[model samples]
Target: MGQAGATFPQSLWDPSFLFLTSGTSEGGSREGLWGHVDQLNRTLAQHTEDIAHLRDDLLDCRAQLAEQLEKNLLFPQISTSLLSVALMYMEAQRKPDPEKAIAGGTGD
Candidate 1:
């Protein structure tokens, strides 16, 4: 019931929830209570470390998302510029050179 496998009630680990169970006190001793408090302290310390690791992971994800969003915003403008260049090239190819066209034409 305590610390994932211990035989004591889980409530003893948290002083706020602690109640003196009949099993814990035949003559009212405090040693057992102190041991439970120590275990609980260790458990809480480990949890703080875990939370810090999770915070680092979340921050990394946020940075990656911002980079992707910037690329997404820029893609449309790049595509539009490329398309304009391609259309201009095609129009140029369709037109004959001014000198060639004039020479080939009769004096009209």
Candidate 2:
């Protein structure tokens, strides 16, 4: 009598330990438990891989967006400076009499 057979009585009164000794005789129940464990481990590994890939993609998107924002922001400042210079040049050219223009007089 092995330890498994000795620990469990031949009666069905001990349902817990009875399954351990009385089964398909081919260890089918034990194999089922191991199969479940393997499936759970595979699921965990797949989820971990998916999360890592998503994190890397998010970081890459952030870097690209930041670069685009920097370029967009810098473009407006350059455009504003160019417009200001053009306006200043136009105002300087329109002023026929500089002294009168500064004094706010029509030169009458």
Candidate 3:
């Protein structure tokens, strides 16, 4: 085989493609293959864990947003109800003026 690729510095893409081929064994040892496999497994496990955490965070954020949206949607109605209740309470607490009641008496 020609050493055209080996003559220069190894590019960034070489290692990923090289290790999969039969002729490019890492020092002609099976240990290298197992090492790569183990690394890949660890990476996969870490990614799975990260994805789970992200999903949980997303769900929590969604719940919070839903709650805030509910509050926002009902704010006007709640305020109006409270104002009406306050007005009703004020109206109930007001007493009739004594002078007006006496002056408006029937003259028959």
Candidate 4:
């Protein structure tokens, strides 16, 4: 039971699935992603689909990780060294709001 060469798909690291938000996406973590997803349908209509697609990919990635972990099973310490995963935001571009920056520059 020492198959330690398991692999995860590239979709897990796809840059398109990431975005930069002023606030943490903890709302999504709180079982409210779909609830608030529709709110973007009117203004950022495209993001609605993007968000949904990203959610699907994330779920798929989790499933794949589980499957891979099963295949890579071994002694506890060995298995831990066999697989290391890192989840991170892409931080695509730093498009700051000039008006907000200029207006709020002085305050703490």
Candidate 5:
């Protein structure tokens, strides 16, 4: 075929390129592949451990938030009950007892 019509130049098919395509390059050796695989395994193991720790931390945080939410929900009711009791006591004290007032006693 004419050079002008060739898809690629013949120089591009060098021996090093052939070796790489044939899985015979330095990085494609058995030992190199095994080393790469080992590194990948180590990284995956570390990531798994980190993910587990994060999951546990998330669970703890959710539980703490739930407890705080429960406490927050109860506080208003508790405060309202206490206020009602205080107001009732104050109302009772504000009105004088006629008998006690006539007996020269401070009725409030």
Candidate 6:
């Protein structure tokens, strides 16, 4: 029974062979459905491969960035050391008192 007490036919409720054949034919050849499925599978495989490659590339970039950061952090110390050596060389050229400069340089 449907809405408002309307009696529905028993055949409408039954699973008949005619209903199955008509439904399949209306959607065209089954081969087309199989082709679509194959295309979907190929696309999924390509995307999976792309994702794997991206993961590897991302990991490589992260390692390179870490190495770069380590080098960058060491740069300031290197620069300061170089500057100190240069200053010492300049002071030596000026013949400034070594003891005074080592302790505290005279205000000139």
Q: Please, what is the TM-score per model?
A: 0.54, 0.58, 0.53, 0.29, 0.57, 0.51
Residue-level lDDT of model 3, residues 1-108, one tens digit each, is: 366655332553666444443445543445666788799999999999999999999999999999999999899899999999998898778776777778994322
Runs in model 2 with CA error above 4 Å? Answer: 1-28, 92-95, 98-108
The C-alpha local distance difference test score for the whole of candidate 2 amounts to 0.78
Runs off by more than 4 Å, candidate 6: 1-23, 78-108
> RMSD for each model, in Å, please?
7.5, 10.2, 7.9, 36.4, 9.9, 9.2
TM-score of 6: 0.51
The alpha-carbon lDDT assigned to residue 97 of candidate 3 equals 74
Model 3, residue 54: displacement in angstroms? 0.6
Distance from true position, residue 13, model 4, in Å?
A: 45
- Candidate 6 lDDT tens digits, 1-108: 557865333563454423433437764555775687699999999999999999999999999999999999999999999999999888767856678877897623
Candidate 2 residue 4 Cα shift, in angstroms, is 32
In the range 7-76, model 5's lDDT, one tens digit per residue, is: 4325637665445445565526656656776999999999999999999999999999999999999999
Which pairs, if any, clash in model 2? Answer: none
Best by lDDT: 5
* Ten-residue stretch with the least lDDT total in model 5: 18-27
Q: Give the TM-score of candidate 4.
A: 0.29
Candidate 4 weakest lDDT stretch, 10 residues: 84-93
Overlapping backbone residue pairs in candidate 2 total 0
lDDT of 3 at 21: 39
Stretches of candidate 4 exceeding 4 Å from the true structure: 1-43, 74-108
RMSD, candidate 1, Å: 7.5
